[model samples]
Target chain A: MTTATQVEKEFILNMGPQHPSTHGVLRVILKLDGERVVKAIPEIGYLHTGIEKTMEDKLYYKAIPCTDRMDYLAPMSNNLGFSLTVEKLMDIEVPEKVKWARVILAELTRLNSHLFWLGTHALDLGAMSMLLYALRERESIVDIYEACGGQRMMTSYIRIGGLAKDLPADFDKKVRHVLKLLPEKIKEYETLLNSNQIFINRTRGVAVISAEDAINLSLSGPMLRGCGIRHDLRKANPYSGYENFDFEIPIGKNGDAYDRYLLRVEEMKQSLSIIQQGIDGMPEGPYRAHVPGVVLPPKEDVLYKMEAMIFHFKIITEGFKSPFGAVYQAIESPKGEIGFYISSDGTNKPNRVRVRPPSFLNLQSLSKLVEGSLVSDVVCAIGSIDIVLGEVDR
Target chain B: MEHNLNEIEEKILDFLEDKFSGSIISRDKFRGDWSFFIKPNDITLFCKGFLNNYELDIKYLSDMTSVDWFDHEEEKKGRFEVVYNFYSLKNKIRFFLKARLPAENPEIDSITNYFASADWMEREIFDLMGIKFKGHPDLRKILTPDDLEGHPLRRDYPLTWEQPVFTWNKDDPPEVIK
Candidate 1:
């Protein structure tokens, strides 16, 4: 008979600025005693590009594309938050059609982000096939984006004052197709993992956090909702015509990885309904708001008319001068509440542009959530939070 | 809606004036948002009141960031401003608190005791802006590497300045590749 040696000391393990399961360049310093994690200190900033500092040097309109790079998965939502801040500072109300169209695009972007999250979250938990199915559904949304914005992933479509252009002629057809196909596919995802023993064992009762702690840590969106807190910014403080839409905020009971997964899946369903409402009730008016010297003129008008050409030239060259004040505008991003705080100094260039990235703040709770849990559960905890390092290190 | 805002504003202003009378330097209302400049030392006190007050239980801390005013055109209180974005989840309202720190050594008390989320926010501020957060448990560089010298977000830090090669690992000599 062999006698077991007693191991009393905790060893430190560095889990990657290069590991595959981390989803990006994120390094977690895990202090462990055998198989249990005593403390998990997440060391980020490997992917820091200083996008916020870069945005301050660029013109106001030039900064929109930079926002796209922050939350690469939810580019349109980031654009919306930045543009809403600029509009709020300039006091420009978008046309009704622009509002409705923005709503559709934003919800579609939310769907896009959630689909990617679901696929990666499932794959990390050893369900390999879920990724393929999730990516297939996500491709359709990308097609819609390419059709509208002329770019696939980094589509800076939603510009200040209005969209880059009008919605494509086939926008309605493509959106309705996605709206019809997603419900059944979402059910397929649920059927595959909802009852699977392995999935439940990996996620349920693992990396649990309470509602009060979640709030204290400033976790938002699905992270907060997973803790059974019914606080959705879209419902509580509606912006960009979100008040007009009818949807439900999903909450979970356990605040574990499983509950967060279910909440994200249900959120995808809610997003489909919102897209349906957007397409059905889109108002009829000018796609871009008429703000000369501020909003860019239509391409057709720029080609045909001299005044429109002059306005375009002015906006492109010098850029629009904004009033001297700061405004914080937040929107319900797929990850959480992504807000932009802009402080203008009566110049074309912004004096300060601070992005309140949800990923950065949400990732702060990683240490709190992963402490005292098993080492294997660390991946589950990170996946449940759904952090994009691009946004986290921005 | 506007009338209701006026009523809430009156009630909260009355309550704040009654409670924190001396700490509030000035207040401004713009674009339906209220901002108050509080004394740097009394921020934690105001935040405690904001959390425990029945009507103004602003428990959720949305964000905390710092702004550098090196070449700013506007007249300001100090060379640096730390902005706190607080929200009341129950009442669904947003407010701002700003504290000004002098140029010599910009320092403020960390709100980690009142709001746990301020840990990383203060660390980031300390890292990028070089504003010392007194009493923070882990006050170290966050978004930047450990070897970085100057605060990158300050106006004095040049945008095009480059870090010298192998400076971070200076102790380990580099071998020549023939």
Candidate 2:
């Protein structure tokens, strides 16, 4: 019998299921060759909650709340995507005010999502101050969320018919106040991150993916846009009256982390433009459409009026039946083209509900980008992709 | 009679009269959608022919997924169906190709040879729906785990194995809700 060799040739590196910096239960099994990742085998499902099957059992209306769990960073966008699919299947028309409200809130949510991305992403790279500063700016949007929906993080505010309820009387003022302060705060962030030498050296050419490769990998949102793909679902395929709004699509030439960073900085400015237009050209109408039977009557209306009370009772108990059909609705979420495919069987419960989450696709490109790069470069690659595991694992 | 969407459907139907039948597909100017039910073996040929030979140029494979129709109530021969959504990004035309495959033996030709984007997508289908990608190079799990047994997206799969917390009015079980 031969004695076992004293020296070990290979060592296994176990990444997080509970580590804070892994962002979310993303356990990556890295085969190491002396600080170099030879083969990266990602082990997922620690955060697997089986969201898809639950949607199959939940009714079309009941499924909206579940969406809040998908991309917890941008719950509003997921809510919008799911709601849009239900609306398409039901073939219910939304009011102008509702569209504007969706755009504004969705944009605010985009800002919220990006702030979290920038914070956590910068935090991963040891930019401790950026995380604090970014979170400080993001708190305004969280406050706005709390004031409107009585929840800060997962606000199931955007309902299928139009909204959970009409925008509170203080909605307009709170939104405008935040909008006014955002431009200055954004400039402050740009000044800090745009010219920082350490940040520049770390991100400039790291994790470069060309436009063609980005498309082939099916990357979307900022990752795709960062690769000079002048495509945004809001622009390419308009939903929620995005056509009426005027905004520019900022493209990147280098298709690197720096380019992505630059593009997002510009995007924040463009988002500001879109929000201003939405508020300026804000239409006045019934927040929800005239689909009385489909939309739940207001609490006050239900409590006061007998007709409203009866409709509310029926809607709450039996649930409004949607048209029997399948429809796929996609929206330009902060991440990318978040698509919702819903199948209705002429019943209260949905036959099927599927979310084509962007982070999942964006994360798919990780292997391609990480295949040859250094292990340290992996952090930048992860940051550049800006994936939320909530959406990815969902 | 001109080249309306219905006319196109009728034209395709007339061309492939040997394969399809019924009013399930018609040109009613209805939903304004084009759907093609293709044979599992014919998907590659159809996609290539639809793009190159037929000048359909369906260059963009927008999404490809497999669905478990276990709770479908149809009791049909097949328990699952694979859906491929194609888009001609140039012409702005969209076509949906669907194929039914038995859940017991879910195997189909991988479309990665035609559209490179289908590589990860097919792997995802295999990972989530347990559809065996016959010709895929890497047919392992993309989003889940290596040792994970059941595909979680299937209708039969439970949402979560964790038990619920007992409320004030509800009866409390002895076991911990883990």
Candidate 3:
């Protein structure tokens, strides 16, 4: 054999467009010298569905359902962003009840997304039982989605003008049940992972980035906050009545995977507080806005009244026209800042609909995260980012 | 209450007018948000100006995308418009910068040198919208296969167009789905 100094040590390794740890179809090309990664180039687009192009062809309100399919984990957050952008473009002020109800739904979605992330991330790090525990808690949230939107994952319940329909009869009871149960389960998860030796070894100081680099890379959500940057859009720029609620934005000291894990766990508690505030301070008003010929009328009214029936026929046949302008609206989605930029040409269909996906931005920092770490740390870093490939390749 | 411009708006207008007055094509406020249309040549400098300025520290590049304004009714600058959305974390304000490029060879200087986040966003605009980003180091297609024919997001590209599949058995007829 040749001497160690004269040998060719560097080699190429392809880590997946199909691996389960990637969370979706994300392929990373790694240049390795022994076990240390010299350079990691991420190759995406295996899940490309051309969603932005498809959205341009559909009517304004009809495109709401398409948003659900992108970030399938937190569909309500996507729906909220798209609807807020279109509502701003059209200059429609939804009722007070709608805002409070939306806050409730959006916060619930944050809990749902974070739970799934915690489960899958822990499982990736060899904590096998966390997956079962986390998913068991997730089922209750899925039940709420089905009770409200009739679909578990693709719940396009939050419509343009307002919600798809009023809250279900037992919506209050079901939400209250989740609210009471999750706080204890969250504490239990902390007890399991906080003291575990394997998790701390893999996560702490694994992928560290400073606050300045995090901002320079344009990271958001927990990614930015984990770097000790206090940048939550809900507090920085409030929307959908998020200003009225009171909650803490948990931040991390070090920009490593372990800090991110702790920050997200604290965020679950904060989400619960926001949900509690929403349920306590909910106001009474119309479920949907009263913009005739634009917003869909109530089913009972459409069946009985002539004007409601005529308006329904018009809205179904040809969607209402929007003003000629553009608007950019962003929300503090569970992943990060998911925004929608819509340009209308005074037509029923939007001129351009561009989604500023949070996962796409967060995924860009992978090369930096796994710069000189071992190949196994790549899995830890990717799981930490919590990327949904559907949104990344959209 | 809505008639008066906010403090941040006044300050941004004053700064832009003071620093780079001649480059601005038009500035408008729609639904309480401000957007500026500037010349393509001045985009890199304008981004530099925003980043270097102490008061208007608009460091974060939220998004960069293009709109194909084909057969539009409203008055616009050119055939293709590249929009950049920037947010100032310090000032807590948003600034929208836009530049127009011709349809034949739409091109603009990439701001990746100024902001590292501009790398992937610029590549995406190149890959999907077919607008070239000059000086982007690795401008390969991000979301599409390498052998694809044309940009899918262009308005001229048919929505339902499908790519022909390659097969080993060239003698067999290609299967078609209506």
Candidate 4:
């Protein structure tokens, strides 16, 4: 009955499915009233490839590549999670050397992922130079991936029983080269943003989530740690011989966007230290376990030995069978806790393969973080969560 | 921690037996992680109990997913199973709870009240597996388009490729590539 000017109007704003800041093809629907968001609903699955359904059709060993595409940034961690789950079900144990190498590769993967997040998040917040500098450091890590796995990005190096192959002869030297350079590179990144007024002003007190709310929302990795919860699966659960390596779980007190930034920076340093320790304490043994039917034989053995050739042929034609059971294995991927739940019906192919992708869980907290903040801060809030749409849509 | 994990599992089993009584169908352990199957009717009650239990304090809902068992022989009771993965941050232990739902009307009480994280997960299940979550505030398709016809994750849903509506060349009439 009143005039139109007297009534307050709220409108729905669609943020993305194509916008650069939303990370991938993530579309966020926002109910706004004059620059203030009333409700934010994230519409996902634009990149959905039905990887879970596809995995069920693939053999246990063949499914590793599909995991790589989920969290494309941290492919090795995905590989480690899938492999460990399968290894647990098969009751196969890799040697100590395999464990050490796997840890190194996984940490490198973490560093690679964090670097990408830092660059992209900075770019989202208008810090253009940070992207170039971050990518410069990431190049060396990509080289390491390429050297070992023959692919830069989707290196499914970590296999079911062990590694795809033993570490290259110069793997130590190449890793040491990157490790030596990372500290200085990280320092440069910190110097760029740590005390910068614009960076601090834009990030501090923005997208704040409390410790209780974080746990209730099932946030993980730096998202939970930024809320002052010192929980890292690498430390708490200790899969892939993480117990052997000594590294502190970085925690943040402010539980804001800036705090998440600080936590990821600290995690990069810790990952470097873990990589250093792994190289120093390298164990000497076979790279893969001695599960003949399940794990592929060495290339040399396959070429000469008849038994090895037969085993290889058998495995290539018909993949190894797992018992009828279900197992969940979680690893501390750079994004968060990447868990795999596999149910096998004593067949070459899995009955069901469910990935508990960290990005999917972490992205849920975005609404809570951005609800009360200015609509302009939405990009910062989303970038701080560091969600890879590959993982989210999977 | 090792001793505490065992104690936690035992306490959880005891609590379920004492509280739910006849609801629990079976229990099993996989790679040191405990999993329990509960009757569909008591899922919400059991989840509430577990989440609110003083000692257990299963505060985090890590994942909420469903599995279609249309092709499996062992799943005699139902055609679909809803799986809930819970983690206790205080105790640093994880346990999985599963409930069976018939294929006809796969619906369960939503746990969004207990864990806000369950909102999106429940929606994802609904979108992909065609499982409905009762009491969900905004139940809608999450990943898939709203107009998508059938749940893709169901066993009965064929994985065959869909034919494109447009053809690469107009002169050749149309080659509906599937």
TM-scores of the candidates in the order shown: 0.96, 0.87, 0.96, 0.95
Alpha-carbon shift of residue B98 in model 1 (angstroms):
0.6
For A1-394, candidate 1 gives per-residue lDDT tens digits of: 1233344456677787798788899888888888888878888888888888899999888899999998899999999999899999888999999988988999999999999999999999999999999999999999999999999899999999999988999999999999889999999999999998999999999889999898899999999999999999898878889989999999999899999999998998898899899899988998788999999998889999999999999999999888877789888899999999887778898878899989998999998888888988999988989999999999
Candidate 4: stretches off by over 4 Å: A1-8, B163-178
Whichever of 1 and 4 has more lDDT, that candidate is 1
Please state every model's RMSD to the true fold in angstroms: 3.9, 6.8, 4.6, 4.9
Over B1-178, each residue of candidate 2 has an lDDT whose tens digit, in order, gives 2255455455444543433333123222214555555667777766565445354334666777766777666328477778777654334445567777876778988878777678767877788788987778667666654556677777787766444423311132112111
**What are the per-residue Cα lDDT tens digits for candidate 2 across A75-144?**
8999889888777777788989999999999999988888888888778877888889889888888888
Between prediction 3 and prediction 4, which has the larger TM-score?
3
- Runs in model 1 deviating more than 4 A are A1-8, B165-178
Positional deviation of residue A378's Cα in model 1 after best superposition, in angstroms: 0.2
The 10-residue segment of model 1 chain A with minimum total lDDT is A1-10
- Ranking under lDDT, best-scoring first? 3, 1, 4, 2
TM-score of 2: 0.87
Higher-ranked by DockQ: 1 or 2:
1
Any runs in candidate 2 off by more than 4 Å, and if so which?
Answer: A1-12, A31-36, B1-32, B47-57, B71-77, B91-93, B116-120, B141-151, B156-178
Computed on C-alphas against the true complex, the DockQ of each candidate is: 0.42, 0.21, 0.43, 0.41
